[model samples]
Target chain A: MNRLACLVVVIGMALPAFAQDARKSGFDYMGPDTQAMQKDDLANPGMLSVLEGETLWNTPTGKAQKSCAACHGDATQSMKGVAARYPAMDDKTQSAIDLAGRIIQCRVERQEAPAPQREGRELLSLSAFVGRQSRDMPISPPQDAKLAATRAQGAALYSARMGQLNFSCAQCHDDNAGGHLGAAPIPQAHPNGYPLYRLEWQSLGSLQRRFRNCMSGMRAEPFAAGSTEAIALEAFLMERAAGMKLETPAVRP
Target chain B: MWRLLGLLAVLVSFDASAQTLVPYRIENGAITQSLTGVKGDAAKGRAIVVERQKGLCLLCHSGPFPEERFQGDLAPSLAGTGSRMSEGEIRLRMVDSTKVNEKTIMPPYYRSEGLERVAANYKAKTLLNAQEIEDVIAFLVSLKDDTQK
Candidate 1:
């Protein structure tokens, strides 16, 4: 009887890990008109930023005169599936960093260039270009004991109620995903379709920009782009978005 | 001359006294102690029900205001709340509807006893002031089955 009970407890503990399958990207939640727009590379507005990034990939700059192509060789092969695996835990720093943070790191250390600002156009282009390489790839940020704590903090931040509205991100994205806020539909907000174009902004932007906008919507003060809070939130969102396809430069309303 | 000096004193104290709030308690969707002189204008109430930046009622509750498009459907419609619930019931719900249902999405407009991650500047502040709650209650109660009558 004790052996049977122990087996039951062990199975119960492992059930959660096996229970979940790949979640649908916010892409699946978009209306037909938007879906059609995202499916086509030419019609998609985000491709423009991808093109800008392609330019940056080849153009040499900084003291090393090292373009992305110089070290990585070709983005089509080198950067494939790279974006999907970040905000990954940096082995050296023992902390998580998003794709944009990684791009800045390479520029400052490898290329000997000035550190680009978080919201700058150059960074957006580079991120979009890198993201485009991983288009349709599944998001699967590396996981383990070391990264778990930061990701947990990110998850807490997502559920924590903030501002005068007292709305947690879960209240909308988790509870009300695919629901309407007025005429507009709120997507589940998996970060798959990021470094994308937004009609509201009329240009390419990083995920940090969207985070700031959401903070404003909640009437909470937004953390700075590279701030621990922002990074933790990104790490959390990416973990939650595991299995969703990357749609970098996705256009949003 | 004395009246002029007294008026000056009153003006000086106005800034410090502006944030004072009248307290109330909720129990089972009703105000435990009814507020006296709680006169609310139907006109002001209508404004609060429809405004997004202030009351945010239309964000969750569909109301009878056709002028405002795209009202939410999360909560009970306020189109005919006046004909259904008593004025006292409505007042309590606005004060703190959690007394009736703890998981209600409807935010307490007049109570601030428990909330999380409120901005530093907005601590102890309710989403709507006391007068606004009364005004909203008045607006809700005005929507009677008057057309049939």
Candidate 2:
């Protein structure tokens, strides 16, 4: 009777680990060298953009000639833990907006500057700067009824097979993670890192840029930057990576 | 009439180059006929399977290749594939595994239609040509020994 009871207890203890989807940060999958680079601000190339962003934050531009600092004042204080909670619901549009989208909006609406092109240096710099403020903080996606519906849509997109290859994001990143595709290892694809520097790109990029690269590789029609599809996926990723530490302005191979 | 015939010829040639799938029937979950109506070179097939940018078979399957430093565990091992499945069965899978199992992760190598959101450059382009499919089938058929793994 005691043996059976112990056996039941053992099985009960084992079930949760197997049942729960264990989330891992993308940083866990990278090599020691890459991890070291990300750890040190001086060694990380993405930091240069952060530096540029700091300068841009304080400098006045556009017709109104108001800098981001003029309103927010001291990004380290105002922006801390901010990037961790995006893609947030924009009050005016009632649509999900990622960190980069928020910056572009601020540029256009608040500063009265011309909207910067997507993935351009100015945008990337500001994004990296804002994102860096939330480094090491856990991802905390907003909770709202509308946002939940959007998240559900994002989850559907994540699992839907598309392209000539007929692959979903879940297939490679979820089912085949930690396995090699040729010489490259497939990471769990948590979006904790943004405005990250990729060795292949040799420049800083946003999460949406990474999405397009994967879609193109799958021979799928790549989604445009700031598209509904892009925002939805970003929302889903942020939620999926909930509690994982942010590593914005990260370096990746 | 000659100009009309010439235009027709140009259109036919363009269509042929754009699409490379050869018609083959699926019966009882197998394609009994070879895609090219000719046997393929096992050596060439082996080369294609191992090439990182080509077959990409090792991405989701471990196989008998000893030299490959890494092989995936996402799907079944390719070892003993010949003893496990016939040439026709292998051909059907290579052509389109989704027909056999709707949830299959294997990409359709010989299919070009009914795919969603295909990039402009990849539209009407199959992952492998008819001859290439035969080559892969030939290589898979050679692996009859389960112990080779």
Best by lDDT: 2
The local lDDT score (0 to 100) that residue A216 gets in candidate 1 is 73
Taking the tens digit of each residue's C-alpha lDDT, what string does model 1 give over A41-99? 88898898889889999999899998989999989999999998888778889887888
Scoring only the second chain, what is candidate 2's TM-score?
Answer: 0.86
Q: Which stretches of model 2 miss by more than 4 angstroms? A: A1-10, A15-21, B1-20, B66-71
Q: What is the TM-score of each candidate against the true structure?
A: 0.84, 0.89
Clashes of 1: 1
Global Cα lDDT for candidate 1? 0.78
Which 10-residue span in candidate 2 chain B carries the lowest summed lDDT? B5-14
Writing each residue's lDDT as its tens digit, candidate 1 over B1-149 gives 32343334321111234355575544444663544466887899888878888888888777667778887766667877889888878887887665556556667676554566555666667788877787878888888863431
Give residue A11's error in model 1 in angstroms: 19
